[model samples]
Structures are given as structure tokens and as C-alpha cells.
Target: MSRLRTPASPAYLRVVRASAWYDLAVTAGFATPWTYALVHDALSSCGNALGLGALPELDLWQILFANLMGSVVVVWAVLRIVGPLPEHGLFDGIARALFATWQAYALAHGVSQLLWLFFGVEVTFGVLQLVPWRRGGNACRARMRNADHRSTGRSLT
Candidate 1:
């Protein structure tokens, strides 16, 4: 059977393209600073909370090293936003950033009682993103199928 072509509205296509750009900019902008601040603040607070006398004296080198390690998260967040991943979807981008942030936190802080909080948040967001939502998978599959069918049909005709 000959396939019918459905015309896409220019406005819709523009919106879709714009969404990817926007997601890249917004996710990277927010995730980088937020991760940095959260990691630094949490560590500083934890030191005080543990009654470590003069929390500022709790090894400046270790604190700097941990913060530097945690900054690796910004790289992942940027990659998730601007790399090959589909950027039009905000949820996946956010999930990726969250996971990266948590992973960085875990790596910087090492396995400890407090690290569980970061791990839990990261795992929850990561798992939620992996879940199949209504029409989500279908839309992706349909696009791929359409492309494949078009390429094959062109060759045949």
C-alpha cells in the first residue's frame, strides 16, 4: 500500500527544535551551580552536625578535594543536556543531572550514613526516568519506524 504523508506544522516543528535548545541551556545552567552548592553546603553542615570541633579545621585539603571531585557532576549534566540524548524531554535531562549529582556526591564523600540520602534521591529519580510512560515509548518507536520505512520504501521505488 502507498503510504500517505502527513504534513507537520512549521510552528510545531519549530517548538520541538526550540525545546531541545532550551533544555540544554536550562539544565546545564541550573544543575552545575546547584550541584556545587548542595555538595559544599551539605559537607560543611555535616561536619558541624557531627560536633567536629572547629568544623573549618576539618582538613581543608579534604574539603577542597571533595568539592573538586563533586564538580565532575557538572560535566555529566552538561553532556546530558547538550550531548546526543534527546533534549526535548525535560524529565530525562533532569533525571540525568540528578543521578550525576548523586554519583558525584557519593564518590566525593565515600560510603557513609549521610551518603545514603544522595544515593536514595539519585536512584529514585533514575528509576522513575526508566519507567515507560504512556505514549512515550510509542512516540520514539514510531519515529524510528517511520524513518526506516521511508528509507526502505525509497530504495524499492
Candidate 2:
């Protein structure tokens, strides 16, 4: 049996791009202290409004980590936004799985309930991107087989 597989479906790739947009929009504020202050206040207000615990005050070390994470995620988001390839989704899906794991760990360790919202989105997009959705699976296999035959100077049919 041929080992190669078809690329992700167009619909799935769209979902991947959508997830990247969400990441960029949400994390962009954390990329800088100036913007993070605004985002932090907003998140705190939101959490308080919802009766969820607010994020704690961050020291320099915490701020540095937040800035690093935000910068990395923002760059990753731009990559998918520009290219939106099937492979991008696969890698992004894996990253989301890791992020979701860490998020869950934080929630269990008495982190803010606001994290639940992000956790939900992470799980959703992660699963969507992780699913195997080859474009016309059998057709792709047949096409590949035909190509192989053509290379060998033979006809598959």
C-alpha cells in the first residue's frame, strides 16, 4: 500500500487560519507592557464581572515570560495567516494540544477561572485541526498511484 497521504481539506485549512487570527487578536496585547496593562485591566474587569478570580499582579520575571509567549504566538499567527497551508495546521494543532495541557494544569493549580475560556478555545481549534481530513482520500491515493505508474511508463487503468 502507498504510504503517502493527501493534504488537509480546504475547509480544515480555513479553520486553521481562523484559529491563528484568534490567537493574534487575543495575544497581541501581551506582546508589550504598554498594551499588556490595558489588556490586563480589561481581563481583570472581565473576570471580576464574571465572578472569576482575576490574574495576579505580575513582577518583572512574570512580565518577561508573558511578553515572550505573546511575541512567539503573534509571529506564529502571522505565519499561518499568510500561508495557511495544511502542514501549518498540523504543527499548530500539535502546539495547541501542548498549550491546552499547560492551561489545564494551571487551572487545576488555582489559576484564574478566566483561563477556562481560553482553554475551551484551545481545545476546540486543536481538535478541529488535528482531525484527519484528507481531500478526497481515495481519489488522492488513486491519483498518486497513477502518477507512480506514469513514472514507470505504464497506465494504472
Local lDDT at 29 for model 2: 96
TM-score of each: 0.37, 0.80
Evaluate model 2: give its lDDT.
0.82
Residue lDDT tens for model 1, 38-116: 5456565885586532123334565455455445444544444454333233355355566568667756765444554
Q: Give the TM-score of candidate 2.
A: 0.80
- Compose the digit string of candidate 2's lDDT tens values, residues 44-101: 8899999998889867887788889999999999999998876677788889999999
Candidate 1 ranges with C-alpha deviation above 4 Å = 1-44, 47-72, 78-110, 133-136, 144-157
Clashing pairs in 2: none
lDDT of each: 0.45, 0.82
lDDT of 1 at 146: 75
